[model samples]
Target chain A: MDTNTLTGLKSAFQVAPSDELAKVICFALIESGEESEIALYLQQAQKTLDESESLKLAEALYQAELHETARNVLSEELLSHKILVAKCLNESGEPEQARKLYCSAIEADSSLESHALNRTFNVEVKVAQINNDDKPKLKVVEKMDLASVTDMVRYRQDTSDFSDVVGLEHIKKQISKKIIMPFQRPSLFQKFKKKVGGGVILYGPPGCGKTLLARATAGECKASFFNIEISDVLDMYIGESEQKLHTIFEKARSSTPCVLFFDEIEALAGKREHSRNSSSANVVSQFLTELDGFSQNNEGVLVLASTNVPWAVDAAFLRPGRFDRMFFVPPPDKVARKAILEHHIKGRPAESNIDFSSIASKATGYSGADLYNLVEMAADEAIDESIEAGNEVVISNQHFKNAIKEARSTTTEWLTTARNYARYANEGGRYDEVLSFLKKHGK
Target chain B: MQEHKYTMASECFHRGQIDRAIDLLRELLAEEPNSADCHGLLAGCLLEKKRLYAAEYELAIALNLEPQNALFYVLQARINLLRNKTKSALESCDEALQLEPEYLDAHLLKSDVYLVFNKYDEAKACIDIAANLQPGSVTVAHYYGEYFFAKGDIKTAEKYAVDSLSIDPQDEAANILMGKIKLRQGNLKEAEYHATFVIIQNPDSNSALRLFCDIKMRRNIILGGWWRFNAWMASLSNVQSSVVLISGYLVFMLAAQIFEDFEYLTVSSLISFAWIGLVIYSWVGIPMYYKRLRKELERFSFNPEF
Candidate 1:
């Protein structure tokens, strides 16, 4: 079209001034490189056109070789517009900027990957599907069966031994003589007509290594360790708890030399006289039956239970042939505390000059867990110091002192309650050990 | 090496084979000679056998072996109670409590002594504290019932007894207390029912048998005659009998005053002599009843029913 004809047609359309005609005039102005006229026409057309119509107009303007105007009109309002603007830029010889826009568009919306790449390629083929393994490959992962993993974890043998425990020499010795010895010398126990398998109740304050001690006992016996959580045995459905308990015991019996450990046994074996309902009473009776093993053999199944409150346990459970052997696990003594403190700080970053004895002495009635917490608090203090100094700072004696001030012993309340029982309620002198402990402490 | 014998002893004890347990515990002790648990257990056997002196010796050795043992202290308390050394028994219970404050058996034993001493307030405090500590404890509930019964709070005592029975229907102490409460309430049939139930469970329960006998004597008294005397005799505890004797002496003194006014010296003198004789009989008989009850309790392996 001649410049004279374009000017004639634009004047004719300006007189009519219809939206479609104005759009036509705008396209013509764009084709003829009439930048000022195209801007004026487009500004008027934008008010009338919707978003999609405006996009189409921008595309037409790009096809008419108005790259800058098309990019300005696109304004990233639509994904397709973005692809079009990138294409216009690439065609107009600004490939770097075009590639960046394409990459960004795909990044913003992952579903646009193939479409963005295809628009860049100007073809139907997806770049990702191309056999270009040389570029990169996603890391491959193998799926695992959860049931098998659980079985592996549940049936695994614990290799812990009494040596692994920090202290409690007397308790360890008693457990070995009563429990491990029978396992090692079955014939000796058998000749005495003693049932190889029997139950023992371990009572103490919380976090005092009761569970850890049980594992060590199992390790000492070289038995398969089956830790039965009270939650696992207690079911919401009636008779289910008994069934679960029965299954656990049967499993232990079948897996000869299995150490069936029930932590927090008081919940499972609370006094029948204290039971509020027949369901709990039934559970107790079921437990008693399992312990008796009237028809079944429990020759190598060692049932060990631990509780923080032995006084809550049923009296019948303490009778002969049941949980006859009872041991009261107390807070670690000074030597044990020292050992525990050392264990907590072994791999941690601490100063060589830090006095463990000072910390141990400060933690008079601390449990093993309490010691671990103290070390953690000290390490945290060191971290704050390190951050303030803008450099690495080792845990210092000062940090430990700070931790000591912050972390009080968790065993005090337990001991206070224990003293009451030990002092007034020690039926049959069953709490002699507790008495001896109180005496030693000058309590 | 003698572990098997020890096992045999424990098995016998659990099976209520007291004689067998005694023999095996003896044999095991002879072989090992240093087992504190064996000694303590042997003392328990002797305690059940009613051999108070032998039990005391065995318990002493056990305590010597494990001096700080709270259980041994409780056993020694029981032994003292059997010997009628109320003071010594209370001291032993205190020592046990000193060793283990929350020992339920020790608390129960202390409560029993308080009941026997007629220290109703002390008994109530001990059992109430135990009850508060372990609300659902059958032993504590039973002791609280006994405390109420001793205080003559029959209604509350019956409630506690029923509460205890609700927890453990076959509990011997609860049933015996129930029988006592029923007898006090004049529910003779209910009293007989509970007594019979307790006897079925533990025929040697002295409290139960006494309540049964008294109930029977009362029923016979309805027809009058010799049954009146026996019923009257059964009606009073040691403390009640002492009070009766004192009142009888005062009444006789008034009668003497009336007789002296009329110049009846011989009748006044006779009344004075009878009153003195009655006082002496009461002084002897009251202790004998307690002695017989304690001896009967010692004969059984179970906890002694108050």
Candidate 2:
């Protein structure tokens, strides 16, 4: 671990510039506490090392309490490195600089904004602690106020019920029985030892109205709807994501007769083994605890989650008392497709007696969104014809035919992937609904 | 504005962000549904994702809107090739070539379809035309290597594969061709090296997996046979695999009934037992192959020079 040993390790790394050799050299330098040697090694390897290798070396340096060295090793060009450098700066008591770095990284990549904002919050807290003043606390409060001003979640009180949703009568009936009835008659459910609030997961292909169904269910029960986004929970700091999740659950619990709708729930509850980092797994674990932990009462706080890929979700989330009620929101059937087409074309100028059935039959695998696109396409066709003739022309069957030729269903790919999962990985028959739909649709 | 989005979508597609490209194209198509370029680009993205039916539908629309577009015909040929309709694929390629006789992609695709049909002479003619069109193209070199390999000229194939790799070492087709050539030469280690290189970059690549299985079989006959068979099964689409399994079952049942009708009770029982054994082998083969592949990968990691 001395300078000679460091030199020997450097020579070995030079012979084989692999990650393993670089790691060995880093550990050796850290063990010897040779600051000058570590600086020299960083300066030499800066030109030769790739981004991943530099990140590794920076991580090792950070672990050894060499914050400045770690910051020097990381490149400012990469957003990922910027976050790590911000952490190093925060550790070295440069909270303001760290906050600036986080802000810049967030500006560069909006996907990292939530994580950066959480870090900035932590930095404000640190600055307050260091200054021994209440003014920093006021600044923090002002920042929180600003955040609330720009917050996306509105706690909407939608008035639309199942009547607003087109087609899927069977799904609506089931939702009414499993979710709505419990909320409407909680005391009766308690008498029967049935919980009023539990987890229900609605899974289907993209643009198949899972979110719409959740909103309708919330309206049907006359409950407050809280749409939770992934950004609302995930944080860059360790354990902060879990804490944010707990706070969300607590907020829902405080407001009874509330529906917490989480779309793309798989991002939060994906299988632990599939996660690249422990933070994601911890978030999933925290989610499970919030769902059905000891000393937790979720009555009148229904959780509705939807995902396009239910197979990617963790199995533990589907156990009884968690997301036990799994509903598959399939692509609109032929009848449903006709209804959706009619619904989309209601306000548009069109022929009075358009043959909707022929159009619907051609849109076999179209989702509600795809059908909406088809109508838009047909309207475009009509508009083009009107422009050519210098007069407004009503959309006709010919326009529909022209639109059908260009607009293809987007659900077929999802069904194809889902079919594989249902056939091979249908553990506990969780994907039985998907399998049945595929069979009936001849997918 | 739609043209800008189309350009952006094409950039995303080239950068391997296919889902993003598809989203951008869909948005553009929503605004201008009659834009054949957007539909064709979306079809290309779908083809890359292996959503063949959707890709075909989109390409058909693109062709309908612009029947004279040779690019749409080439895209159609690619979809048909993936669907295993070699004749239709050839026809589409010929149509594209007839529209634009010097089109390099159409010539290469025609060569590929001819190679699939084992028409080595036709494949060679197409490859020759392609090479003349793009003499220094890595793709043309790879196609020439494939043509030679299909013709059983291993030395020439190896030379062309080396030539292609020297020009672009990361070319997947060239690496697969080199792996196949190495396999033909009975150089199992080199073949494994080439296949593993491609598989590490793209684990979903069926050709690399097939070559890897072949190399494994050359090393150990029994386990390798199972691995090869499983790889072959996995290469098929869900519907195709199901048909294969059902046809296999029907044949087994037919053989058993014939044995019973001939009063060969022992033969019939043996046939039934053999069928059961084969089914069991197929069932367990997947997990076993994966386990063995993991061990092999671990060994490969430990000895990087290997």
Candidate 3:
């Protein structure tokens, strides 16, 4: 069979193309090592081969490290074949083509979306690496145009109220008295010349339910919620970020009884002196103007913001009528920790009497998200046990015991830094709440 | 436009906003992939973040794009030093010096590599050249302080540290050196003040944190003695520590043999037992010290003035 001429083998395969004969012809062609003849054979046989024969031949060729030949044999019309061809192209150092094929395959098949998206990202990285390796080439440089920024300001009509939140009872009460009460009774407040809408800043360690509390505040007040993403307002171009900020403020003002929530507000309102970019200072100024400028009417447009680093925010934003009410959302207490753990473990496969209270007591200093992760870690143990036992294994006290040993509170580091700020940098009693919280926690 | 972005990225890098610098460089590189300065600055930012391999890759591309750039070679030397390839790092520094013989950073980095290898004379030579090149350089003053401190000249080290701090009171490296100098001089309060100042500015500074640990250990006698002993052991390089241990063992063996020759069997056996105990403590002391240090750090309360 190895001694057979390439022309005879090609004719034999063409006369009656079977998987075995196609494999033999591919092997003979590859063994012959005639570059032009092999290229001619592949080009002529690409359209003639059926799907199954092409797939088998391509698989064999791919295993032999003939990537281009395998890619040439596979058809793009079929989704499965396109994926195989994409793999071939990626292996053959044609990542851009492979990315395009994967993208098209994702559009044609929803089930392959995640896998195709991941492959596309990997190939895109490869393309970037290749481009980085190339020598300097003179090309027309295009300026970054910010003519149309993507509006990622998510508007919510109905959201979960404070009832759905896990902990921070004092924060809820403060928000209710200072923020929710105004929206609930605007007419009564109007008689006393008290504005119904003002700014409130929720600041705390991350994963302590600041963003959730902001959402719940809007829900409790029965107002429209505009969850303003940082990307929605931040533009690389100078003045564009300020413009976007104004547009977002206008949109919120037009919708009365609306909660404009900015998560990670420090990114947008950091101290101007700390920022090297002048545009960042301009953005902060724009934010302050939107909050309480003479031309701006923020009546019925409540501004709620949350930041993990409250000390980084500009002092100007903390004045009266602009983020006037600052709430410190500390990590959950003992009782709140138990409730959070129970909430996370509610629908999971778990034993009824798992001694969550005991676990919660052990999980001191855990934030709400930390407790959720603890439950997840416990579930992972249960899953491993189930896989080993070849049956269902409900999460038990033993799993929680194992997880608690491995889990460390991420709040400790944040609190350690906050302690310094609270103790030393507590000018005007801005971090007075943090100081009290630290003392209460025996820091 | 690319130049503007590169300048912005460089400013971010100098401001210690490493992640933001990396992001801006990535965006700029996407538009201007061939910009070697962008790649070199990105590598420096990645080196600050301790992404060694990625830094090396970016630096390699940068050097490939502009083979004659001395700054990229210095960055490559930094990545090599981080990876513990001291010889490769020296070669990179030399390559940079070959391109630009008067490069101050190259001289300073070569000094750093020599200091790592305990080649004090070579380090001092590099520092002297750097000082001559730029007399007002805070970095040169800091390196001089480091060299004198390594040579155990506490008075000279303190003088250089004060000089560096006078040049720039806010310089982190100078302050760290001053803190160490004060620590060695038994001025715990002054040492702690320097450490805390740096910490308040940048909480993630490991050197400042380590200096704080030393000051706190000194203030507390029980943990302080053990912490000091462990810190002494830690200051020795792996080879140096091993040599010390082996020398101690050999001395003990010689003493035991001399005692055995005099028929002092109990004393010789007692000496052997003491040596074993010392070995055991050396093996187990570091982890225990670190555990205690962590607990102490957790319970750290601020001084009223601080």
Go through the candidates in order and give the C-alpha RMSD of each one to the true structure: 29.5, 27.9, 18.8
lDDT of 2 by residue, B7-40 (tens): 9999999877889999999999888999889889
DockQ: which candidate is best? Answer: 3
Q: Per-residue CA lDDT of candidate 2, range A1-443, in tens?
A: 66887787788777767655655666576677654456655665576677887887788788778899999899877878988898899889998888788878766875765645575546432222465554443221111222342254457775468988999899999999989998998889999998987899999989999999999999999998989999888867677678777777777787788999998999999989779899999999999999995677898899999999887789899999999999999888878888998998998899999999988878777889999999999999999999999999999999999999988777765775565456545768988888777666551
Q: Please give the lDDT score for candidate 1.
A: 0.77
Model with the higher TM-score, candidate 2 or 3: 3
User: Total clashing residue pairs per candidate?
Assistant: 26, 0, 0
Better of 1 and 3 by lDDT: 3
Model 3: per-residue Cα lDDT over A1-443, one tens digit each: 45557677778767876555555565566566543344445655555577887887677677767778777788788877887788888887888888788878866875665645575547432222457678665543243233322245788988889999977788788889988998999999999999988888998878989988988999999999989889988876567788888878877777888999999999999989789789999999889888985797889999999999888889899988788888899888888988889888888888988897788778878888888889899999999999999999999999999999998777766776676566545767888998887776652
Query: Which residue pairs does candidate 3 place in steric collision?
Result: none
| Stretches > 4 Å off in candidate 2 | A1-152, B1-306
Q: Which candidate has the highest lDDT of all?
A: 2
Query: Candidate 3: lDDT of B83?
Result: 86
B76-150 per-residue lDDT for model 3 (tens digits): 998899889999999999999999999999999999999999999999999999999999888999999999998
List, in the given order, the native-contact fraction of each candidate.
Answer: 0.00, 0.00, 0.02
List each model's interface RMSD: 17.4, 21.9, 9.7
Model 2 chain A lDDT-worst window of ten = A137-146
- Fnat score for model 1: 0.00
